[model samples]
Target: MVEQQQSDDNQKNSEPGVKNSIKKLKNKFVPGFQYTLIIATGFNISMLVIGCLNVHKCPVNKNIPLFLIATGAIGIISKFTTYVRTRFSKHIQVVYFETSLYSVESIFFFLGSYWVYKYYKPSYDPTDGDVYCNKTAYLLAFIYLTFLYSLLLVMIFGCCCAFCCLLCLGSGEDTSKAGCKYSLLVAAICNFAMLVIGCLNVHKCPVNEKIPLYLIATGAIGLVSKFVSYFRRRISAHVQVVFFETSLYSVEAAFFFLGTFWVYKEYKPSFDPDEKDYCNETAYMFAFVHLTIYYCFIVFVAFVCCCIVCVAICVSATADTGVKYTLIIAAALNISVLVVGCLNVHKCPVNKNIPLFLIAVGGIGLMSKFISYIRERLSELVTVAHLESSLYSAEVVFCFLGSYWVFKEYQPSYDPFDETKYCNKTAYLFAFSYLIIHYTIALAVLLACCCFTLCCMICTYKVRTCCQDMVSVEQENDTGIQYTLITAAIFNFAMLVVGSLNVHKCPVNKNIPLFLIAIGAIGLVSKFVSYIRDRLSKHVRVSYIESALYSVETIFFFLGTYWVYKEFKPSYNPLDRTKYCNKTAYLFAFIYLTVHYTILIAMIFGCCCFVCCAMWMAKAENSRSYDVESQPTNTEAREALTTNDESEAKP
Candidate 1:
């Protein structure tokens, strides 16, 4: 019996040991972790070699590479320690080596890389600017350094995030929120610093425009993602967040490191450097185009990935049907524009009508979506209340001046001295389109729809009032106003496009009206779809619409302003004096130029209004949360408290 018991006990102990061995084996091969280990080892060995070489060359420069070697060695050791703990230890204790050491090592490596590349001349001739360094060797070295530093950044970010998660795990909701908020604050600081440094040194040796752009894009994306993550943490962050971030950093590291070597090969360095500007201009243009296109791609992919993860994981925070459908419509619209762009393949604005049309539509959509969202949330917003009034005032002024200018200049027949009827007719047609469209169609629709909708809503509210239930009569009114404003804005935007195109008399420009009409028709369909979705779905999110608008606004506003001020220079045009100087037509040109400046001013105000509205909305959300939490069961008491608080604050 004793012998049997001893054998049974031994078997029981061996079972757990076998399982533990299997677990350790499984942990050793975590896909990214093992790769990280290999990279770390390679980095440390290379740094040591580089340090020894530099020490042999110059005694003073020895310390620089030595510091880098020391820091990098520490990083490799820390990474190994991390692996050992993860694979073998039952209780994994968080250590400073894995977190702070990575940052310290990254800084040292970054400085060392810059110093070596900037000073070391592999092969160069004083007579002609030429570097005869083994191109492949330099390229490989650059790639290895960039990969190491980028890995360090990813490691730091992961460690910070994981630490926060661990601290917040099993804590109360408030504590978790605080931890995430603090994490975000730290991330923002680090990213902003990186951006500033990259910008200041972007034009120097070993630094380029791509570096600054990467930092700026990364910072923007991280801030937005972290904000969303803080509010809702249902997504498997380890899989989604880390994967996207790793992809982004990896692309940056590989592209930029290789790009630097390509630049070196293309623009050979001189041993005896001169103060002559001999940059390859094509390189700048190529960089500009690449960054512009790729930045948008990166941001959009990141946002959509996060949205998918959030929607899939967070049951309570589901995406609105309207948002999904809007994305589909936007994708179709963008694809159509891309097709047009590919077909045209020209330099002139008139030839690029489709892309310009896309821009105009995006701007209009953003403005309309923003108006609708704000109207729904805050009916008493000062900006919304005054938007129509300001627009009408501007319209009345434009109408009187425009009519006077046209009538004064117009002649019945072809009289060159007096403005020809044809030219006069086109001018009047373009100039007064807003007033005519607004007075005839928009005004009628606004009045009839507003009155009918209000009547229906009032009746619905009366029935709900009798039943002692909350009625959305006010919300219905907001929706009504939203539709009206969107229609009006689209009309104005279409007219602007038509008027602008008319200024250029190319035959291709004639097709612009047809394009505008088609886009407007598509807009109507989209609005209809949105309406139906809003009616059936509980919520509508227009963030994509907002993003599109921002792009349009920034591009058109800045570019148009610069074009008018520099390229067109209506004030200094010789043609304005010779071609249309017969009957005080210059006055009309002046008026038109004034309108451009006015539009610029309006864009500025729109930006300000957007910022203010965002702040107000955030405040309102927080206050509502507080109210709900404090007054969960007391309806009348909550109402009284809200009334008192509002009165006190307002008065």
Candidate 2:
């Protein structure tokens, strides 16, 4: 009786485990979760639509176009798969569903793997001048385009590879792996073609123009990785990934990660729900930032090392050792500044607006330089006088002078004269362009000035540390350091009172939440700057708690300020737009932040819930859970035994 009762409980409990999961699935697929899923899926589909439209709009095969196309197609298919899995049959579906999911992921992985191999080019920003261009852009097309082209090639090849793997682990042993075998063949062919194209490009391009050829080779690698993975995976259900092979695979995957990101960066998406927008696109930006910063920092160090060697040669050649010593000391000073600027993003979070104005001035200088460089290259075609005058007062100053013109031309719906014409489904090809006019030159100027300041700080620090004991060097360092310190002190004071010297102004109208956020941030900056100014300090005018809390209250004060600003600014309305749901600008920012945080929380929670369920299931095994009637897919031997028992029985 006891044994029978225990057996019954075991069956009942175990049965509910599957039932709970099935029930959960039904709930998730049916209504609440389904709605959001559809929305997200639909959004991606819209982006795919835009991408497809754009591909035809400005077709180019170098790389970006294919990537956008592949991404759009893959994303739509993924969403479609979700819909099928949810609405379609449930049993034996997990394997098929998994296969589908893996297939989609493999496409991205393949694309990414090859992208990593693409030789990187310079960013769009004129500030990072590894390669100077005729134009400037916040969106670095060269870097981005190169990466995408690489990834697309990889993904195409990878899909073939995936097919091969699927066939190797064929749905049934009796069924032929024809589908996978064919895919393997195609992948192999594409890889060979890639090698051919790569070698061909090498000869076509000059040594200096080896960039184009390198990019092509990177693209080929992406395709090859896809081919290899597909062939191996198809043949073996559990292909043990060897370290040597895995390292090669890792390199392949890297191309996709790096390359796909560049493609994404170049996407000038319209307000298409399908595309990742300003807030959502931050993730892509971060990825680019990681790659670019790492790339720049490493390359710059190399450049600096080369420059140091040259400087040493220059010093050795100098007739006067005293002057040579002074020059070397100066060189050291410059090197220090570069180091410090690299450390904290040249203190970008500090004075931006003033730097912006300085950049505008610098823009004039660079415009002057570009025109002269071109004129020398193409002598007698363009005059120096017209070029020089055009730069000094022609571009940005005119725009600034015409601020009133902006107000006049501003259609309530759109900025009629908005310079940046980047957007939509057909945006990628177009997005690869640069603004050659004053904008680029001006932005570059600002960047250089900012760099100058950062360099100054770095040099100052180096002099103090490296020349602490040296008599003559110490004296020089003391003077230069004094000047740098004074300049920084003035800048920080200004920033605290307002914001970055580059673009800052105290707006009469303020959104409270943003203001509050700013206040809290500024307080932190103030404390940081104060610490930097003082070598050591113990005294406080007020208690730490009082001052800290006061800083936090700035946020509240700003909220109150905004409420007043809102009341006063009667005509200024954000919601009068014909298109776009006026979710309230500040409110939207907060909401966006909330949504991001919520997604993170939900993922963590979902993982925890899975762990809990698994643990509970493990404990339930204590009871006599074995049932004679239950047919488990535990082992082929057990199934064979059951078949033998059945055959022997003479029913």
Candidate 3:
């Protein structure tokens, strides 16, 4: 009798339409999650139908209503998948298939809802001349759809987290397996947040429809899959997830690159001969293009790394291996992007400093990835996580510093059509402050990482020094720690200088270069002298050569800045313009500025590469010892560092 009762219970559990405890409660209060979505979908479809029927009376294009219709259809399909999954939960294969379908549907629905809400929602002001405008009803529908859409995203992500937790509870404690789940959660949260914020402030946000709609569609679709993961948590379970994430990341990066390049390709290289004022230079268009491209790039990258926990979810490879591969792929994509960017940079609208800043960003990623590859091969001692965090921190610092300066220099007029108002102080200040604060926080985080890395390196070194065999290794590793410490100190010092100089005008133009020159000369001479002494002592050190190159590059950058300032004389006064320069001279100055900054940027980037590599390689070698076969010989390291330095010194 007990066996028969057990069989009956099992049969009941396996049957379709059976409710679990969670579902029972959910159904009683919420009218079924899937059913609610179906109802919401029906409401949206009704609204879209109304809009379409009155398209002739509406002032807007008919395409707007059609878009709403498509999105409504997507919502219906997504809800259908949800219903299937809920009803047939006992069928594992069906569950998996439905989950994938639901995820895709959710993506489409999210995008379609976002578009309709962003672009199609009518402004209900009664003063408007449009006769078909239903101000109150339309606003109410907009609010309802926006809420429903956001709730759908949040609920789906929440369900994934809940499911993951249940799985962990059912099995054993394994933290690594939970990473991709968290990544998805974070991505979904970000999307939801943006949706809320955008909807709340819909009237305030500006829309730029200049970017190719097709590319935008591709990017948006690719990015939506960022948070979705395979249900299986086996060794190979997350491989498909990684493939999709990385592939999408690459595609988004490609689109941004292409968009930036397209603008450059179309931009006229030379100023129009009939132009009246230098302030009205068409190059201002470059700033607008860059600004647009920047926002898109930032949005996509955010989708990829909303919080940047950087946890490895791919179980098939080592933790660092997965991360290294992701970064390597990203680097390759960035390189291709830079190649296109460089080819068109001459004509692209942007301040000379912006490209330089971009180069530094790209170079930082490439060097970090290369360091990871080398360390992995050599089996280095320091924890990959710690080192990566520190490196990322440094990259953030450099990025912010560059960003602040670029914004400071490239303030374009907001009103291109109005000739009288030549400057947009409000816009300039807004952009400058925003970029500055954004990077400042990033820099602070990086500085914290550097401090953490320092402590880790010291403690690890001390622990290893207790063993006699590790004494030499410790000494060698200390060089890298030293480099890191000095770099951090110098970075702090530079920031202080920037802060002080920015406060006072005379000090910045006069004192900053002199300060840099002094610092560079001292470091350059000391490193060169140390290199000579080390050679005489029958010891060869790559750090000295690397340091010397950085110093030289520093001097070159500062000197170039000064030279350009002195040579590129501009006349604000129309009366005595000939005394200072002609209109053609102004054009020449612009060209010179671009070329000059480009070379300086390249030199600085190269210097940073060699120094950072030298430091990372040095530390990584000491972090862990490897078999002599895979270990990089000191001679080889020196050769590689020197080769890079030499290349940097060239034009």
Taken over the whole model, the C-alpha lDDT of each candidate is 0.43, 0.40, 0.45
Q: Which lDDT tens digits does candidate 3 get at residues 291-352?
A: 46656765565344422324223332445556666766766754653453344333323344
The lDDT of model 1 is: 0.43
Candidate 1: worst 10 consecutive residues by lDDT? 578-587
- Per-residue error for 475 in candidate 1, Å, reads 9.2
**Cα lDDT tens digits for candidate 1, 557-603:** 32232223222222333355422221122232234445755764574
- TM-scores for all candidates: the values are 0.29, 0.22, 0.30
Off by over 4 Å in 1: 1-200, 206-483, 503-543, 550-574, 577-651
Q: 1-651, model 2: which lDDT tens digit per residue? A: 999999999999999899999899876766675576667556545544554454323211223333444444445444555554544445213323333333334444344333422323324344545442212111222333445566666776566566656656656643244565565566556445545555444423231222223334444654555454554554445443222223234344334333433433344433233533422233333333434554565457546544544554565453445644544453443344333323322122222122222222333333333443334333455434333333432332323322222222222222224334211211111111111233355446445544654675677676656754668865676567556645644443433233222111223333333343333333333333333333223432222222222323332332333243333323323343322221233343344334534664574456346545754775677443655335456696788998999999957
Q: Is candidate 1 or candidate 3 better by TM-score?
A: 3
Ranking by TM-score: 3, 1, 2
Better of 2 and 3 by lDDT: 3
Total clashing pairs in model 1: 0
Off by more than 4 A, model 2: 1-187, 199-597, 612-616, 619-651
Instruction: State which candidate, 1 or 2, has the greater TM-score.
Output: 1
RMSD of 1: 23.3
lDDT of 1 at 595: 73
Predicted structure 2: clash tally: 40
